[model samples]
Target: MKALISNKVFRIVAFADLLQQSAIWIRNISLLFYVMEQTNGDPVAVSLLNVLEYTPIFLFSFIGGAFADRWNPKRTMITGDLLSAISIGVILLFVLAGSWQAVFAATVVSAIVSQFSQPSSAVMFKRHVPGELLAPAISISQGIMSLFIIVGPVVGTLIYSTLGLVYSLAAMIGLFLAAVLVQLTLPPSPRPPERRAVPILEDVKAGFRYIRGKRNLIVIAITFACIGLGSGLIQPLDIFIVTERLQLHKESVQWFHALSGAGMLVGGAAAAFLGQKLNPRVVIFVGIAFLSCSIIVEALSVWVYLTAAMRFSVGVMTAFMQIVLGAIMMKLVEEAYIGRVNGAITPLLMAGTLAGTAMAGPLMKTFTLVPVYGMSATIILIAAFASLSMKLGGNAANTERSAVHLD
Candidate 1:
């Protein structure tokens, strides 16, 4: 781990990633509050904001992956950062002009650009990080993400409360510019080989065929989709749990999220330590099993502290599942196809999340929170069982490269 962090490229990319992610979270949280204020707390408008935030991942991830596969990773990432800065600048302009609707437009543009940027970042990791060090590297990355998840909202809220909308947008622009500067320091990634001219649709189709040939990849994608569904089901209900079931104030909900973030940090570190010693498949299975159990336990608990504890446990287990799955993919997929494979699976996971979120309200209205929680647990447990069939080996000796044909 020490050696991995000491590597120059890793350090540069990590720093850039931290700035980029912080900017994104700050923008998202600040915008959410801005929209809430402007719309007078209209639930439908707020929900629409959430939908706008995530919809691009569903619609553009595949295309982004295809482009990432074809483009230089470093250039792709730099362009993304630059465009993000410009987009935020546009938002700042809209805010100054008192055109609130244009702020939403800027949000959509940034979200779309992120789909391209994210896969490119994945490509960079695949290209630069040694296979043995990938898990620790990813763990470090996830830790940064988890830390920001806890801090970003607080920072965004603080800025919004203290400085107001224009200043908040200016802060995000500055962060993005910092990211761009750091990204410029990254070493250039090797370009993919030029092939005979082929239609973009054929390129995407070939990526799908590659995954189709790998049973392990299929299993991982499906398991992740289930996890997304389970997460979506439980997320919206947390507010209800705090407000209705546990009889706590809505503001107290931040405690649950904070604890969960702490758990993610601890869990990521543990997974990084265990990466070389344990089979990723076993790690994923155990994480899912525990996460599912935690959800069920949280549902049954009446006390707020117990539920919070369960939320923390869920966070820890989720970090393990995410890191191990990512490590497995990095190990199996070739550098050329990493982008497309990730692009292909993203929508499956996002669709599950959207579907779960869409279903949670109706299910709660009809069957109540306990049943809805139970249903989510059952879905996650099913994913746990499905993970058992994965054939990921315990060590490098049994690992096999994915049979993906890029041509």
Candidate 2:
């Protein structure tokens, strides 16, 4: 029962995250639309914009992770959030002045600013929350932000379209500023200890060695990679399916995403309330299996509503997977190496996302949306098999070591 309630520090952190996420969702969608509008809906321009957005995640995630470990995570978050706000402001000013170069540069910088906080946020969760509660906490946190994701873009877009671009930019800045304030109120995380005995390169090498020493770590990394791949494809492809394939209206596209978010939110809430009793791995597997089933049905369904229902199921499953994977990550990795582990894991996921997105565009060429997305179900089934077949108990050494420490 005590686990249900977060400390003041955690509450502030959570609130800050919710705000950050809301702003990020609105910002990403707005930027994409803004770029498309500026280019007069050229596909090349849209693709380039995507490249700019995702490139930082691929390149600097490791560096950012290292920075998070080197500095105070809370301070890092505040700095990153502030940078993000500044980036948007710059873009807004440029757009108002009709400077395309400025707009493009600002958009590119925004991705870098956003990526900086990724590691710090994970570090904070590791520090403030107990391992047992980490999954549920993350699930809850994600759920709240996701719910905003369901509505923020649509409303922000409406405001942007009707009220003007400046208003949309202002709204994004306001949300980021709010997030910064909330983060400021949270208790500061103590900085990670510097390892004087080893240089940075050696430290990175040591982190790699540590992972190599554990088999479960490898599986976990691979699993996360697959998850990322699935997400990148799922998002853009699902939109394509809903609007282009199913003959849904432009406004209706938002509802499909909203339904998916709603399902994930419900699943997350349930995990937050009851995740302590469930095995983390089991939860992830169940999610994969459920998504597999949903994908199959979605492929065959002639109606748009059925696709929405499938998206909702996938969301629920993703929530469970998130809870379990997050907890395991916190539990298994050492404090010194969490940053590196995260750094390594994140890029694989990024690569996977890239792979998924890249393939999604072309795959639709060979087949209809139904059969193509339906194929994702097979991938999920593979994930379920992988999850069950892999042994998480490979870290018995650490478990034994901890037990010995107690004795």
Candidate 3:
């Protein structure tokens, strides 16, 4: 904890993340309430907001990552945040002009810019943070996100209720500008390598090739696909665990999310303290395996307390898996390729998520809830076993040799 607090780079990055997350939640909830009010709770309009937010991740994540690799990490992050603030300012003007429809632009523009900024931040971490502190650093990052999950919505709602849409948008812009200023305190990034006469397309393709050659990266990519599918498969059906399985009111679902968030906060702390002593792959494997069991238990249990326990356990394992995977990925990849590697792996997760989310509803209609949940858990279990094949243990030296030769 002391080491993490003393690390100048981590402090800068964490502060920037805090500011950005504050802005995001404020923008998210404010827009949600504003749109709902304007459209009289029209489901299509509300859902469109989600589409605008996520579609950019599918469309631009890889492209942004490629650019992040080509640019200076610190500069790219600052530019992305600056662009977000500028775009939000423009949207605020539109709102002031009575073009309420322009509120959707705030979600889309930030979503698109974050893809570029996020990978740059990862690259910066890879560059500036020592490998030994990587796990704790990632744990701290996850803790911030988890903390927001629990508090962001309430804060956003309070701001929107009190100040209204225009002020909320202004607040988002202010928070973003603050993030940009905080990021400016980041240590100067190393100069970017000279541009090869290579096209960006070729650079992207090389990223694919690089991942293909690394055994650990391949395992991580595959794990992401499985985790994505498993999580997405249950995303739409979680509420059913309350309404149908436990015979409780649908509103009871909030407890599940609340417990999960609390669990993530605690789990992040545990990971930070224990990370150095644990093997990353083994941690991931055990975490996923535990999560798979929790899903099955939750799906089967009619007892509310039992189900809540499972949800909390799932959150803890999720924190462990995320922190470990992030630390290991940073450790495994060279600094030069971190952006591309991140870009390449992320799409698989997103694609799996979209695919599973699209299928979950249809599958639930066709089969019982247990069967669908079972299927998801089974996929996650497979990922757990697959993680065991990673050569991070006794053959760690061999893997490093292979990675260097491939590079």
Q: How do the residues 1-407 of candidate 1 rate in per-residue lDDT, one tens digit apiece?
A: 88898777789888988997777777778888888889999898888877887898888888888888888888888898888888878777877787887778767888899888888888888888888899998888898989887887888788888988888888888988898889898887776777777777787887888788777888888887998898788788889888888888999888889999989988888888987798777778899999888888888888877888888887888887788888888777877788889999868878898889988899899999999989999999999999987786544324444343647
Itemize residue pairs with steric clashes in candidate 3: none
- Using TM-score as the measure, the top candidate is 3
- The lDDT of each candidate is 0.84, 0.72, 0.88
Please identify model 1 stretches exceeding 4 Å from their true place. 394-406
Q: Residue-wise lDDT of candidate 2 within 210-269, one digit each (tens)?
A: 676666677777776766676556656766666665777777777777887888788788
Against the true structure, whose lDDT is highest? 3
TM-score of each: 0.96, 0.88, 0.97
Per-residue C-alpha lDDT of model 3 across residues 1-407, encoded as one tens digit per residue:
78778989899999999999999999989999999999999999998998899899988887888888888888898999999999999998998899999999988999999989999999888888888898999999999999988898889999999999988988988988999899889999887667666787787887888888888889889999998999889988988999999999998887789899988988999999998898777788899999999989989999999998888888888997889888888888877688888888987888888788989999999998999999999999998998887878557756665664322
Which candidate, 1 or 3, has the higher TM-score?
3
Q: What ranking emerges by lDDT with the best candidate at the front?
A: 3, 1, 2
Q: Alpha carbon lDDT of residue 309, candidate 1?
A: 81
Model 2 residue 167 distance off true place after TM-score fit, in angstroms: 3.2
Best-first order by TM-score: 3, 1, 2
> Could you tell me the lDDT of residue 323 within candidate 1?
89
